[model samples]
Target: MTTCNYAAPPFDHPQADVILRSADRVEFRVFKLFLSLASPFFETLFGLPQAPDGATDQETKDGLAVIVMSEDSKTLDSFFRFCYPSTLADDPSLENLTDGLSLLAAARKYSLDLIEKKVCQALANPKVLEMEPIRYFAIARNARLAHETITAARYTLRQPLIPAQFSEIELITASELLVLLTYHKNCSIAVQPLTKNLKWLTDHYGGCDACIWLFGPYYKGSCGCGQVADNRFSPWGIHPVTWWATYMQEISELLMDRPSGDTVRTAADRTIQQVRSMGCSVCSSTVKENMTEFSNLLALKVDEAVSMIQLEMDF
Candidate 1:
């Protein structure tokens, strides 16, 4: 039998009843009562009768039964910290998705529901979710976490369709990837209407004397500002300037690549410049404020559209 070796602080308490030996050989001296309270798996484990063949003898260390855990020291340490009441003040930090998933796996394995809940909350942290949403989606989907999978998949829409490669990519299957891709495609389809249809804006431009020509041929309201001769169909079928067409086209293409409100919000720099530079004098002066308002509206609508799209999770 291998001799017991090391014990880290907090896990090295002298009054503890059991020694949980991590696969990496670090021993944690903890109370069986805490383990029993935290995990049904451990509770049933401790309630079992010892083997008559003296098999338990080889696992003993310093008069305490040594429970060898499959998890390594790092995972064991984090897992135990959640189980122990004393460590509740400083909860484990799941700074990254990988570490969060690892701790979650151990918590789930031991049937620690409360610990699993905590790990899930950490996984949903905005920093953690936005770090590498594709990787998070793959890992969460593989683990069959429905909420995490959907949340991560939605976050991925903020990124380009060709996701950055990561180690966790191997965790998901082709079918799962197809689901995400399909969801992305559906979101693009949903958002394209925002660019094509102008009815959603209603009559916001109704009273605007400077940009009335943008409604694409149905403008009887007023157009003191001369229409750019190129007069193309604007929202509400009024013929606006060519720049408006170009602006919407660019926004459409951008949303096709990344269908998210954040994309719409950050994507209008060049287009805004075009609108200002290409519009008539009156339109140019007010374009900045108007465009800002419009872009904000577009972002809100984009988010609303994307929210309606649900990622299908089979696992």
Candidate 2:
């Protein structure tokens, strides 16, 4: 039998006090990693000069501070472990579940690619898997964002599943499923079921842009890549995997019949009156609806429109 040599903390951990006192400082690095991975928030932080390979300890420390001071505590701690592996087993005074989750949330919210990858490795322990939902939520949430590399890493870290007991499979929720699907974009096994579920949503809700964008290719017998694949529909000029949210918005507008000049005027008047009556903010912005909600409303309107048109046809 092959055995694994995992890293563990020593009996007399010398840096325990420094690790605890400066725990918040440790999160700064994690924040930097998160900012680097997410595109929208990337520009907020300024760049730092790289430390020379043969630079003295003081030179390296000074160089790091330029970029490090702007980062938060949660981010700092996450980055610390990656730079110094021995610090992994340091027993910090983790006050509660919230503290741990807050750190994990920062990782996910900022899309800290490297930290997420490492955390997924720690989560592979069976003991960790059996923890409370709060703990599992953190792991699942991050795992959903870490991309395919994390999934591949996890296979080595944990035991394989038994195919015969497929029914006994532990299933993730819709939100969780979305995360997993987003992380492992190329996994056909995972993508197929999600596609099927989205198809059902389309059949029932018809005008839901989110569902349409999510599973449009599959339903239309094309792929998002514009390739004519088996049982997939190509979303022309749309990148299905990345711009799913935007695609749903487009589909919703189409279902709403593009709201003509007359329709827009009527909708605007109604919206103004409704907002005034509620005493809320002015109707400065256009009303936006999710694909699912829009689809439902569209189906009803289509039914009514068809009924009205039938009388004209009959006459």
Using lDDT as the measure, which candidate wins? 1
lDDT of 2 by residue, 171-208 (tens): 33455434423332322232233222344445554553
**What RMSD does each model have against the real structure?**
5.3, 22.7
lDDT per residue as tens, model 1, 182-224: 9999999999888777656655555446444354233453324
**CA lDDT, every model vs. true structure:** 0.76, 0.35
Worst 10 residues of 1 by lDDT: 215-224
Q: Which ten residues in a row have the lowest lDDT in candidate 2?
A: 306-315
Instruction: Provide the TM-score for each candidate, comma-separated.
Output: 0.75, 0.25
**Colliding pairs, model 1:** 214-240, 215-237, 215-238, 215-239, 216-237, 216-238, 216-239, 217-238, 217-239
